[model samples]
Target: MPENILVIGGGPAGLHAANELAELGVSVSLVERDAFIGGNPKKFKYKFLFPDLQPAENVIGELIKKAESNKNIRIYYSSEVTDFKENGKKFDVTIKSPKGTETKTFNSVIVATGFEHFDPATDSKYSYQLFDDVIDIKDLEKMMGEGNFNRPSNGKPPRNVAIILCVGSRDRHVGNQYCSRVCCTVSVKQAIELKEHFPEMEVYIFYMDIRTYGFYEDLYWKAMEEHDVQIVKGRVAEITSGPDNTVICKGEDTLLRGPFEIPFDMVVLASGMEGGPQSPEMSKKLGIELDEHGFLKPANITLSPFKSNKDGIFLAGACTGPKAIVDAIVEGGAAAMNAYIYAKKNAQ
Candidate 1:
């Protein structure tokens, strides 16, 4: 019999890992909580990705296509690992799907459960959901995906828009101190897209620090230089109703050492990512370690981020921590290689 492997989550990392493992002559069982694959990128209906501004469909669609076509892979849609038990060097797993419950044994397991977008509505400061015009990055992304870019309140084109970065990140009050790696770049990308769509409209980015690290800085520069997107260096303390059916951003200009209240037709909160409920659920079910920041803790952060605490189990993608899509795909390949080596070596 062939070496069988179980892959949880049908997101980018899981899809990539399952495909790679299947190609390596391994019989892989992929379980996704969603009825369909593609993860949050699909659920949110992302239009374009940052850095290069490429169509999200180009990447996510391809991964889904590959995984669906692979002969060595069996995908259990809308399913979950209800029970997991270590069987010596191998394991016995029970999968519960819409159809029914089934149990299987596997040589190794790869967990690629992805992260969730922070809900800006929980913060209260951003006034998300309270004001129809006050939305988050994911909300804007969904709008763009549907080819509808207008103020949610009145269904009209916004005259001026404010894109606030680090909405749910790097804030002690929110209990999320770590920086979400892609929010800055993603905000910049959205700013550029807004400018391209409506050249007459004004775009302003309010951020404590524009952290477009590495090559992603180019998009930031482009948003400023090419598109003339104004950036204000201060965090908005509160968002409240303003005159003329607009929202007021009340905060201090740290650069000039003064307070100001600016009104905008629309406000887009660049909310960060979180480990979500799945992190703790997976930790309890799989008996893995969850870090202080709510993500799954790897065996070694530096030496091996893909390896989990338990033997024959691996971690990959945003489930471990906040990361870009490119990084998740790379980690998927790495985890697939490690899992294959272990499964082959310990074959029954």
Candidate 2:
């Protein structure tokens, strides 16, 4: 019999890993907790991706297609690994589905469970759920994807919008202290898209640090130079109700050392990323390690970033840490190669 592999995730990473191994003649059981194939990006309906503003469908949709068409890959949607145990060098995983529970043996397993978006409502400092006009970046992405980029209060085009960065990330008070890695670029990309759609509407990004690192710096520069999106050096301390149907952002301008209360038609929080409950859930179920940041801890973060603490189990994508879609896809391929190698070596 051909060696079998189990992949737990349907996001870009899981989907790509399944496809890569299937191409090498490995039987893959691709399981996803969600009913659909695409993970958060598709579930949330992200319209465009950063750096290039390409349609998110162009990437995730394509992965879904390749995975579904592969003969060696069997998809299990709306399912999860309910039980996992080691069987020598292989694994016995019990997948619970709508039909019934079926246990399968696999030579290797890949956990690509992705991340969760930080909910700004948790902090309460931004009045995220309190104000009608206050929405997070993911909410805005869904709005844009659905072709509705208007004020939530009245469904009117916003005359001026405030994009607050580092909302739920890098804040010790909220308990997450790591930079989400892509929020900065995603915020700038959205700013550019907003400017493109409404040239007259003003866009302002309030950030302690504009961290569009590496090649993503170009998107930041384009937002300022070409799109005229302004970047203010400050952090919004509190959000309160304002007159004339607006929200007031009260904060200090760190650069000028001046306190200011600015009113805007709408507010968008560039919320960070979180490991969510899935990371710990998987860690407990599969007997793996979790980093202090709450993401799945790899065997060796530098050399074996894809390998989990268990010998026959590997990890990829946001499961280990926050990553861009492109980075996740690359890691997916790398994890697939490693998983395949392990499966081939221990094949009966």
Q: Count the backbone clashes (under 3 Å) in each candidate.
A: 0, 0
lDDT by residue (89-163, candidate 2, tens digit) is: 999999998878999999999999999999888997999899989999999999999998899999999999999
What number of backbone clashes does candidate 1 have, counting pairs of residues 3 or more apart or in separate chains? Answer: 0
Model 1 vs truth, CA RMSD: 0.7
How much does candidate 1 score in TM-score?
0.99
In candidate 1, what are the lDDT values of residues 290-348, reduced to their tens digit? 99999999999999999999999999899999999999999999999999999999996
Q: In angstroms, what RMSD does candidate 2 have relative to the true structure?
A: 0.7
lDDT of each: 0.94, 0.94
Whole-model lDDT for model 1 versus the true structure?
0.94
Error of 1 at 73 (Å): 1.1
